[model samples]
Target: MGVGSSSQNSSAMVAIKSQEDQGSAPDLKPKKKICCACPETKKLRDECIVEHGESACEKWIEAHRKCLRAEGFNV
Candidate 1:
């Protein structure tokens, strides 16, 4: 019983470790690419590049809007 319990614990630990080792895991949805232009939207594009990796122009626009809002901008 002790051995069985230890084995089970070990397996669980392995599974947990594997999950952690996988890191955040890529999103199933396709990632978008950023235009890298558009000054009003480039801030978030640059930030996303630094944060969540490269993203699409649309995503950058969205991120820029969020960033601007967070920064107290009226955008």
Candidate 2:
């Protein structure tokens, strides 16, 4: 009886471990983080990057960075 109970527990542990291994992480960071609360700022920054390129879009980028920072996001 003791051996049978131990076998059952081991099987249950294996099943639990398999489920954990197969589960996707919900807290994974995104590939890119757009400003959530500042759509206008994000759009302006995106347009600046498109029209002027990254090197020339410093001010627009900084503005968006500040906005994103204020909203508690790491730009």
Candidate 3:
């Protein structure tokens, strides 16, 4: 039983290491379900666009995009 358990553990380790090497390890989610992610950036982006117009809000918009990408969102 002890030998069998060790073999299984090693197999699992090899699988994880393989995934890491391939850079295919499950890290980023397919999409974030929460609409509230990156609220601070979202707020700034929204307020800027509303007050100044979209063209003037590019900085805030890109900041929000960067924030969403950091939060595992596809944006």
Candidate 4:
């Protein structure tokens, strides 16, 4: 009985693992290409960083990240 129960549990675990393996990750394949994902925010972020440096461009950088996240990118 014990061995049979263990075998059933192992099979259940394998089934669960198989489902997880087949599941698609939401952020794995973005709907849009990276370069085209967030053009407006990217432009603002890039220009800000170039003109004022990274530290000064935090707002724009965060904005770009947010935009990318909206577009299904992990950022």
By lDDT, the best candidate is 4
Q: Extract clashing residue pairs from model 1.
A: 32-55, 32-56, 33-55, 33-56, 34-55
* Candidate 1 vs 2: which has more TM-score: 2
Off by over 4 Å in 2: 1-35
TM-score for every candidate vs. truth? 0.32, 0.50, 0.61, 0.64
lDDT string, candidate 2, 7-75, tens digits: 999999999998898686344343445535678888888898999899998888888878766665666
lDDT of 4 at 18: 83
lDDT (0 to 1) per candidate: 0.62, 0.77, 0.85, 0.88
- Tell me the spans in candidate 3 whose CA falls farther than 4 Å from its real position: 1-26, 30-34
Please give the distance, in angstroms, between residue 27's alpha carbon in candidate 1 and its true position after superposition: 3.7
Clashing pairs in 3: none
Candidate 4, residues 1-75, lDDT tens digits: the string is 787999999999999998898787543567789899889999999999999999999999999999888887776
Native-to-model Cα distance after best TM-score fit, residue 19 in candidate 2, in Å: 36
Clash counts per candidate, in order, are 5, 0, 0, 0
For model 3, the local distance difference test gives 0.85
Error of 2 at 27 (Å): 20
Q: How many pairs of residues in model 4 come into backbone collision? A: 0
- By TM-score, the better pick of 1 and 4 is 4
lDDT of 1 by residue, 1-75 (tens): 776999999999999999888778643331333332245667656766776766445677686766555444545
